[model samples]
Target: MIDQYSFLRPWLFCLDPEKAHNLTLSNLDRAERWGLLQRFITKPIADPHTLCGIQFPNPVGLAAGLDKDGKHIDSLAALGFGFLEIGTVTPRAQPGNPKPRMFRLPEAEGIINRMGFNNDGVDACVARVRKSKFWQSGGVLGLNIGKNASTPIEQASQDYVFAMAAVYEIASYITVNISSPNTQHLRSLQSEEMLRSLLHDLSEERKKLSDRYGVHKPLFLKIAPDLDQEDIHLIAELLVEFGIDAVIATNTTISRETVKGMEYGEEAGGLSGAPVRAASSQVIKTLKARLGNALPIIGVGGILSGADAREKVMAGASLIQLYSGLIYRGPELVNECANALRR
Candidate 1:
């Protein structure tokens, strides 16, 4: 069935990209509250897949950065994602970079965003989750955490730990977002020494949180797709050594090779969508070869269709996520991917 978003896309595209994003989500929330989504949206086929000790209704999920505030969980969940991972939320609220920080490369079906982890803070997100129908009903929720821009890079671990403690009770799993290129000095955390140090701190903290809550929540590390072979291998080794429960093969790429001459192609932010798909798949492929079953890979990068979703799976992603794809495609893409992946 054709999705309602296809019809709305042209009109939405006319507005500023960031405004269009906020408007679409805001309307979705209102539509959901009015009980109109179920009547129009197709439900995703149930293709249960378990990862990190949690059973998801389907393998398709909404990637982080889409709903950074956790304000639209129920509305978005109504769109048929098997799970929803919200935020690159930080310990404290931040207004993000500035206006026009998000740009659309329509020709390449991609987005360049330097929103800089804008969020209403972790405490606010946890409060929002508590009231959401999805979270209340036990829908799988992954909370992505990051450091505040004001926090020095060396003390980034403190910000992460603070946010982790806040959301630990509500999140089905926690994603350490150390790879967003928009943040200054953030990707440096992906380097060997910094990554090892950060993971060590988080690993030890997880033990304490698990003991305190009497529940073990998996930790997922979201990495950049810009790394070379050596970087990928070392990350794989560190993930296992640190006992991280899973890895999100990619976040977004700083590379503009695919969208070079297109409008806003030269924008300085992570380029996500069709442009980053291949690189993301390669990362998943390498990680799967090295980590095997020892670590589950949650593949996410440029999935815009069911075929794209399958490619990630073929590369060994146990599950897949969508963001820019959702912008270019529509809500129906969720069902398309879920149906394709259904065994």
Candidate 2:
């Protein structure tokens, strides 16, 4: 496949990171409308697989954050991802941090963004998802839910409950995203005390929703890569205790040791991309050792090429997702990673 991004990336890089992000999505949205996207896409190899009761056409998926409000789903889904995960949508709409919140660390091939779960409210996102052709197009859809920025930490569970119920019917699975560094005290939800309470509430609600809808949609927790062995072990134990469906091995990391001297290296958000690969894979390896097939693991972080993708699987990820890789390497990375897994 020709690398159209080779021509586009330089121009995109010249724009401010957030502006570039919006432009890429808007352009793809337009492309989908005109039915011109297929001309740019080279379909990935078939590697259909099942995880958490959902069938993914391949192991590679578009991670949440890229299409925060579910807009551009048809365009992104058409780019040959096995599935598409959208949003970290909260119960209510709220603008995120001020400008320059997102930054690029090209030297380390990482990005730091404190774009604190900036998304349309859950209701609005639900409307967008309902309108998107992808929901009805047989592609796997995972809706990621988060707490609103203004909501107090103690009241976080209410936001999660509201978002989960709002999208439960349409979601193939729901992602409990409590690890994004951008949200104040959000990672605290991962602590032993908060995590137990949070999962308990979500699990109980899921049971009722399961009975009501006659479908048990799986729920996965997107965790942080920065965790000690003790933390990982306890989190693994909690997964079994709560009967959680699957685990997305990592969100982004707050640690900056990897890119300390690079531009934007000290930015105040989770750092992602190549710098996150090792930490993310290590988490997967640790979880796999502890869980031992209790549930599937969807690995993500720093997957910029087929080799990087394979590293996550080799570390025991049953599946993988991408965000930064799609930015630097473009859609062809999807096929590259899918083919790597096929081999």
Task: Tell me each candidate's RMSD, in Å, in order.
Answer: 0.9, 0.9
Q: List model 2 lDDT by residue over 232-334, tens digit each.
A: 9999999999999899989999999899778788879889999999999999999999999999899999999999989999999999999998888887888
Candidate 1 collision pairs: none
**TM-score, prediction 1:** 0.99
Instruction: Compose the digit string of candidate 1's lDDT tens values, residues 251-274.
Output: 999998898778899989899999
Model 2 error, position 235 (Å):
0.4
| Every model's TM-score | 0.99, 0.98
CA lDDT of 99 in candidate 1?
A: 79
Give the whole-model CA lDDT for all candidates, comma-separated: 0.93, 0.91
Output the number of the lDDT-best candidate: 1
